[model samples]
Target: MDGDEQLLRGRVYGHDHDDPDPGPKAGRTYAELVGGPLDGLLLDIHGWRTEEVDDGVALTTELSRWPGGRALYDPRPGEPRAAGPGIACRFYYSGDTP
Candidate 1:
């Protein structure tokens, strides 16, 4: 796995029906790990791919809540071997919005 993929591993939850533990039953989500100890790392939200709107909403909302958090949405096609679909969304710690 790449750097982005590795950072996001096991950090995404609450959306996968296949996962034994989905996520929190209520309150804030555990998706935003950007400004925490993993500050310099880049996380690929796409790798956590969720078709459910609720999951997406939760992620977006959490990212928005963090002042230093940044999210980049890439609509281009991704590698076939990638964990996610042919699209990318990256989340990281950046005070500046790109």
Candidate 2:
């Protein structure tokens, strides 16, 4: 797919504000969020620590609660072949928190 199409389908996350480019870049890697409300969303895990990715993170979403809430997701073992290559991890939705 083209850059524009990928950008539209994926959303960047993590603490890499220092990087000049925050958005997805050409050939950049990301993790796919599976299941839950955030399903099908791509999380940009570039520059993220290995432990952080392994432990999982709470992704803020506007899908739940009046003022919004967080969706907890954990990285599953191995890459999700179904998502195709470049998708380095598969974060499965555990639950939601307000």
Candidate 3:
């Protein structure tokens, strides 16, 4: 949803925040989904493209690892591919990043 966007400090992913019908079980809110849990802090990244999968996978893998942080990649086979090489998907992290 990115509705309560206020300078995201930590990495967040999946689901929308603006939607009210969270779902049958009432999924977690945007902030809670991204900022909550705080269990180990999970980062999600998806890269589209049959060939660029390797290139993008390497990137998110590096991003998720932040000394005390972790990240994961789920290409989903066909999420959304970039136009060429300088677009498609972009990732960001926080706290003493590398």
Q: Which one is best on TM-score? A: 2
Q: Write the per-residue lDDT of candidate 3 for residues 1-98, one digit (tens) a residue.
A: 46223322323433233545322121221112222123222223223334554343222223344643444332344445444322233332222223
State the lDDT of candidate 2 residue by residue for 1-90, as single tens digits.
Answer: 884366445555543446565555556667777888877667877667777788897888776442378989997766443332356677
Residue ranges of candidate 3 with Cα displaced over 4 Å = 1-67, 90-98
Which residue segments of model 1 deviate by more than 4 Å? 15-33, 36-87, 91-98
lDDT of 1 by residue, 38-82 (tens): 333222344343443123222232334364443432222341223
> Would you estimate the TM-scores of all the predictions?
0.23, 0.65, 0.24
Global CA lDDT of candidate 2, please? Answer: 0.69
Worst 10 residues of 3 by lDDT: 28-37
How does residue 42 of candidate 2 score in lDDT? 73
Least accurate 10 contiguous residues by lDDT in model 2: 78-87
**In candidate 1, residue 24 scores what lDDT?**
33
Better of 1 and 3 by TM-score: 3
